[model samples]
Target: MEALVAITIGTLTAVGLYLTLRLRSFPVILGLTMLSYAVNVFLFASGRLVQNQAPIIGSGETYADPLPQALVLTAIVISFGMTAVIMIMAIGGFLESGHDRVNMAASDPADADQDDAEEGWA
Candidate 1:
């Protein structure tokens, strides 16, 4: 089960990486989301495999590691913050430029040259 979970996470990360390299903003966002999900699962799995057990020790015979659950929850919250920032960046870029082309600003040679000239002057 752990191996299967690892494999699934690996596949998700691979697909996310592929999507993240695309020339569109939406796909990149989607990829980032998938990658975050994979990372969360991977992190959660790091606490070791526990089946049919509760992390709380109120009245259970088995207690799972609480560290991993804590870490994963923290990661999920952080990922949400990151996702919100990325969404704002993407939306702001689209609104400012009227397009969602990935790396459009950096891909323009004219802009690059102008930046270079500005840097040289500075």
Candidate 2:
């Protein structure tokens, strides 16, 4: 069970990092989302993996730590908000630039004038 969780976290982190390095906005967003999921899972797993265990302390039986659960919950909310903000920013950037690429070409004034002349605009 622990091994499975570890593998899941590793896979998520690897995929997230891979997508984060992409030159497009959509994939970068996905990568960040994946990274957040990985973090949430890791935080949740830190509490405990035991079944039928309550989170309350001072009990006779084994109790799981509630801190991790709370942390995971908070992380989920934060990640959601973060994703939404990034999405809005990406949309705005796309609308302004007509593309969602991260690596935009350097628009020098000289180059613009040369292109305009070539196109018979000037």
Candidate 3:
């Protein structure tokens, strides 16, 4: 069970990093979301992975820690807001530049030339 969780966290982190390195803004946003998911999972797992356990402490029964769960919830909210802000920024950038690329140099040379022409720079 622990191994599975570990593998999942690893996979999420790796995929998130790969996507974050993409040239497009959308993929970068998705990658950030994935990274947040990985962090939430890792934080939740830190509390406990017990099955059939109560969330509250009892006299003789094991209880799952609730703090990490709460933290994950808070993290979810924060990440959602962060994603919204990033998306807005991305849209604004696209509107201003006529491209959704994350980097100017990553755009095709032909497209760059076209943009330059459109801006009366040619």
Candidate 4:
């Protein structure tokens, strides 16, 4: 069980990093989300993996730590808000620039001039 959780976290982290290196805004946002999910899973696993155990401590019985669970919950909420904000920013950027790239290079003067001409700002 622990191995499975570990593998899952590792896989998520790997995929997230791969996607994060992409040039497009949407993939970057998705990568960040996956990274957050990996972090949440890791944090949750830190509380132990005992089955059939309650979060509350009881007399002579094993209880999973609730702190990690609480932290994961908080992280989930924060990540959701962050994802929403990033998506909105991406959309706005796309609308303004006509591209979904996060880091556009300024190496092409012709393209720049064309864009300026199209926008009537040349």
Candidate 5:
């Protein structure tokens, strides 16, 4: 189980990184989401993989660590908020520039004006 989890985490991290390096905003957002998922999994795995055991430290010989679960929840909330903000920013940029490419260059000044005129924002 540990090996499987390790492989899954590695794969997610790799894919996330690859998507993050893409030229588009959507893929970047996805990559960040994947990275956050990988981190959450890693944190959860640190608490150990067990079942049919006590969730809290009581009369049971072993109890799951609650810290990791809390951390994962916190990470999830944070990632969600960050994703929402990034999506809003990306949408605004795409609407304003008429392109989704993140690293848009201003090599052609005429294109910007054309986009503005097309949107009736001129």
Candidate 6:
């Protein structure tokens, strides 16, 4: 069972990474979401993959690590906020540039020269 869960997590991470590398905004967003889900699941699973374990704490119960569960829950909420912000930024970029390119915006000449100098390129 543990092996199967590990394999599943690996597969999900791989798929998410692959999708993340695509040349599209929506797919990248989805990939980020998938990756976040995989990471949250992996973190949650680190508390031991106990079956039917109650998230609540009480007497006479073998509870899984509550810390990981709490952290995962926090991550999920934070990811939702991040997703919303990314979506709005993407939409704004699309409106401004008329394209959904995910690559970094071209640097200004001044900054480019500074960066080159910093990198010892010029």
Winner on lDDT between 1 and 5 is 5
TM-score of 1: 0.80
Lowest lDDT 10-residue stretch of candidate 3? 106-115
Candidate 4 displacement at residue 84 in angstroms: 0.1
User: Residue 38 of model 1: what lDDT?
Assistant: 95
- Backbone clashes in each candidate structure, one number apiece? 0, 0, 0, 0, 0, 0
| Per-prediction TM-score to the true structure, in the order listed | 0.80, 0.83, 0.82, 0.85, 0.84, 0.76
Q: Residues 24-60, candidate 2, lDDT per residue (tens digit)?
A: 9999999999999999999988876877777888774
Better of 3 and 6 by lDDT: 3
* Shift of residue 74 alpha carbon in model 3, Å: 0.5
Cα distance off (Å), candidate 2, residue 75: 0.9
Candidate 4: tens digits of C-alpha lDDT, residues 1-122: 99999999999999999999999999999999999999999999988887877788783379888899899999999999999999999999889778887775776442445655557453
RMSD of 6: 5.6
Candidate 2 overall lDDT versus native: 0.87
**Where is the poorest 10-residue window by lDDT in model 2?**
108-117
Candidate 5: tens digits of C-alpha lDDT, residues 3-79: 89999999999999999999999999999999999999999999998766767889488888888999999999999
Candidates by TM-score, descending order? 4, 5, 2, 3, 1, 6
Q: Candidate 5, clashing residue pairs? A: none
RMSD per prediction, one decimal?
3.4, 6.1, 4.9, 4.2, 4.7, 5.6
Which candidate should be chosen as best, given TM-score against the real structure?
A: 4
Per-model CA lDDT versus the true structure: 0.85, 0.87, 0.88, 0.88, 0.89, 0.81
* Candidate 5 runs further than 4 Å off: 104-122
TM-score of 3: 0.82
